[model samples]
Target: MRKLGCKPAVTRHNQPRLSGLRMMARKAPARLVRDHIDPAPLMLANDQIGDCTSVGIANHLRATASLAGYQIDVSTGDAVRFYSESTGYRPANAESDQGGIEVDVLGIAGRDGYHLDHGTYYPLWGTVDPQDRNALALVVAGMGCAYLGVQLAAADQAPGVWDTDRTGDNTPGSWGGHCLLLWDYTGLGDNDLVTLLTWGVRQKATWQWLHSRIMEAHGIIWPQMVLPSGFYPTGPDLDMLKADNAAFLMGNLWQVPVTS
Candidate 1:
């Protein structure tokens, strides 16, 4: 059985919303995935503990690095350590294994930094409009991935394409909250609109399912990292994004106008 460990996102008064930024003009691909590197999932100990939040973070960074033409692995043990470091989950004390909040963890990662195999990578993380699919495609295409928190339904227990249920059993959070990493997405018109990583496996779910179940979505960028040759991102301006994140952390609400 897979364990869900993501708590509802902590709301900040002036959370940095990516939709407010001026994004690139190029069209996002109808489908995108970093599977060329064939990165495998580590499960990150989610089978036994509620550390999906940390697992999602580890997986996202691994996928991003793979897309950039190198491999940096996040083992199950590493993820467990991260969960303890981030959420204070202890292996011996199950009571300390309580779930984590996505935004709070992301904020910490951005402020402190995440230690991967290469070194500590400081990420600029922020929320995005969960209701906007076009914006989501654009974000994922550019960043190589995004992190999602969903209210799981009972229907999620059975493995197949996760979709809505008509029997009133698909109510959000009916099962619990789970965190997923969005690494690939098909077009908005497709039934299985996105490919996400959860429980150390790839799962496909409809956009409608995502729209209804998603409580929060976030995007992360590593401005200090450079991509491999031939990979171009159609995302936000790094400079403006940095400014906005700084303002968000400092308790100031500053909106940079989208320039032409």
Candidate 2:
């Protein structure tokens, strides 16, 4: 939160300025850190980590999908905000400010397998924090897509402080995300052959692998159902899904589409 009537001395890139006052106040000039941010200014810390501007996501997805020659329509939004003031819709949402993500191909059926529609690995744009209604959640059951969910870490489940079992993460050798494989019947010899993308204790992978990783890291597995539902092959029974970015997806979990 910038304050009114406060200005810092201008800075030049040729020379690095040092200041004891800056260290005390912990403030950097706008010109200094402005370009360091992704996409644009006023885009960070206001929303959650993953709550990035939809424009950045859309552009990335659009270009990538186009290059791949796939029929994809990008929605990159939450379904709830696309409400009608005059219809049966209300203007209230628990995760409304949830930012947008890349949608590889919109309006296409995806069930069996899929190629990357569009997205990038910008970590600042991928962290998930609850924006109440601005945050988004999704559901798709009885299909063939990976499932993802996001939930706030328990109080004790933070870094540098935790109990033996309930202290750390769900994935053993991973961080920046977590994952769970509800079923694994697709991949290899005697091993259920599937994986998922998660963000709790570890990143995306098979359920067993993610779970084991989490246990080793944090000493406990977050109780199932504590995380928000991420994705599915089938969509919710809402008309907005056919429309625009009405899905209201923010930091909450989601899935790769399996329009089989």
Candidate 3:
């Protein structure tokens, strides 16, 4: 399969590393999960020749915005246009129609700002790593969703069933590269399964399937305002706040030290 021109070379330093911290696996009640972001309004009907990357990113932004109480309608056409303009990848060329680059699409979203009905937009943080079930679960439960880049075999794409039992080798050369979004994940350890949105439908696959086939996995950070009700702030968020408060207290403008 053709690779996107904007696809960056995978490197050790940039790859996602599991947070080593242990986290409890709690499944949100089916009723409460239904109340979270809905995939129906955000799915793409059909993407341009090689615009799956754009479609995945756009859908992710749209879903996160919806969770934040803002309705964002971004069509596949819009995503393709953004990718073309941001990456200088001409869509008209069949040879260069590949569009599965995360940085390019996320950069465009941050720069142009995702269109909202109220004329305000928010930025998203992109995180990449190998398969981390706890991290994936935390992101979906607290944030909105996670976007995944995987190497897919012809069979994996066909019925769209990505169970681990399907195959043994899931390396890059063993399959074609593709991008999709992970909206929901359940269970723990070896039993964990994630729900992916691709080509206008949701598909299920084990975390093992992801571990096997995922060349790159991106967890898009949702804005604080959009975090779900039961969400707890991650360590990074708390650390940033502490650092900011300390800096403020040390500055001449605010000499009072934080007692708490």
The lDDT for every candidate, in the order shown, is 0.74, 0.22, 0.54
- What lDDT does candidate 1 reach at residue 192? 55
Candidate 1 lDDT over 144-253, as tens digits, reads 67789999898778777888864448988999999997778666763756788788777888888888899888887776655542223324466667776777668833
**Tens digit of per-residue lDDT, candidate 3, span 26-82:** 443331243355655343423345566666766776667677667567755566565
| Prediction RMSDs, each to the true structure | 6.8, 22.3, 9.8
- In candidate 1, position 78 carries an lDDT of 74
**Residue 216 deviation, candidate 2, in Å?**
23
How many collisions between residues are there in candidate 1? 0
Model 1 C-alpha lDDT versus the unseen true structure = 0.74
User: On residues 59-156, what C-alpha lDDT tens digit does candidate 2 reach at each position?
Assistant: 23332232234323434232121111101122343233322222211111111111223421211011112121111111101111112222223322
After superposition, which runs of candidate 3 have C-alpha atoms over 4 Å from their true positions?
Answer: 1-37, 41-47, 65-70, 115-120, 167-173, 222-225, 232-260
Q: Which ten residues in a row have the lowest lDDT in candidate 2?
A: 216-225
Better of 1 and 2 by TM-score: 1
